[model samples]
Target: MRESRFIAVKLISVLKPVIDRRRRLALIVDDTLMARSCSKKTELLAKVYDHDKHEVLTGYRGLTVGWSDGNTFLPVNFALMSTKKKENMIGNQPVTADQRSIAGRRRTQAQRPMNAVTVELLKQTKKVYYRYRDRLYDVKGLYERLAAAKTRQ
Candidate 1:
């Protein structure tokens, strides 16, 4: 099936007011992993990476994202974290030495953090969806980055 067009009800300029009024936009950031092509169950392996010089524990991971109602949990956003999981994402050395241990590298990746993803996800939530449960339909047009930008403004 083909996805439809996404219309952002809230504009970026107005988001600050919405957030300030409610204190928070009700966001939750997490990971979820779908099976990679031609792969079975997820495995725990310290796979050597081409980009980063060290091996990372690769269980074919992604983010399990959603949102919360202060005291309650409701899924609003689900952004699959970039699995490349590099150090440049963090304020650390952009290179890794093969001589390094898996523990050392993963520590760096974890430290890199997902603050950017969190921010973008929240923004996407406000822009794309009017209400959480109300948007079970696939949003369109937004898949096109340039088009989405025009709508956000």
Candidate 2:
């Protein structure tokens, strides 16, 4: 599907029975370094701290959120993060400020704090839950319908 929120909502619903049995539910948030050192043309590539290797690495950080009732864990949402603090340029070559394009603007916005990104993901999850909680159709049916609609175009 085009929207990840819908899939997240479905996954959450499937795990609802397991979650409801527990007295407390925990939302887990974490960021992982996806190594892409061989890539030179990737946008938003930056130096990310790798906890496992105890060193800095070049790659993108994927921030994710999941729900756990101490047993069953379900990933709900995620966002790619970057540390590209400045506009893209041709290696050390001088460029005017007017040369910054839409990609540069997006890179700056993608540098948001981890907490802010987590909060945004949680808000989206809550919204998806409330909007579809009362629905009766299964996820398979919903996806099939969506597929059919796409083919009609």
Candidate 3:
């Protein structure tokens, strides 16, 4: 995760010049499905609404954010959407004790209502961005301090 964050920071830095020149950049948010229909025993398998398909598909929904410049898209962050509640729409059937326990662990970070998942995804992305932003400022401050010390000598 940390590595991915650092890579995002690097990517943003590389794109900064073009972004500034165009003065237009988009932060895209999207959710996608990773179907697991063949595996009935797959952990956290649930009904996920596919907006484009206009139907509920049995799979995992992945909410992700990315930066785009009308052409190129750079994925910044992502979070898996899981419906682990006892009364979800599709996965209404009861599971055995062992399956329940496994599903519980799989749904540890479960968020509801789609909107909640989007909010969580944005929050996580914001966190990573701020962390890198702060680190950049710290480095700038250090550079300034070093330059001042050199001038004094």
User: What's the number of clashes in each of the models?
Assistant: 9, 0, 0
Mind giving the per-residue lDDT tens digits that candidate 1 earns over 20-124?
A: 445344444544333344332322222223323234333333433344434444455544333333432222232452438764544444333344444455566
Q: Is candidate 2 or candidate 3 better by TM-score?
A: 3
* TM-score of every candidate relative to the true structure: 0.32, 0.62, 0.63
Candidate 3: C-alpha RMSD after superposition: 13.6
- Candidate 2, residues 3-82, lDDT tens digits: the string is 67677667767777655553466666666789877776665677677877888777777766666566766666677777
Report the poorest 10 consecutive residues by lDDT, candidate 3.
131-140
Global Cα RMSD, each model = 15.3, 13.6, 13.6
lDDT of 3 at 62: 72
- Model 3 stretches astray by more than 4 angstroms: 87-106, 130-153
Which prediction has the highest lDDT against the true structure? 3
Give all candidates' CA lDDT scores.
0.38, 0.58, 0.59
- Alpha-carbon deviation at 121 in model 2, angstroms: 1.9
**Residue 112: error of model 1 in Å?**
12
Give the CA lDDT, 0 to 100, for residue 63 in model 3.
Answer: 61
Model 1, runs deviating above 4 Å:
1-25, 32-56, 85-113, 129-153
Residue pairs of candidate 3 with colliding backbone atoms: none
Local distance difference test, candidate 3: 0.59
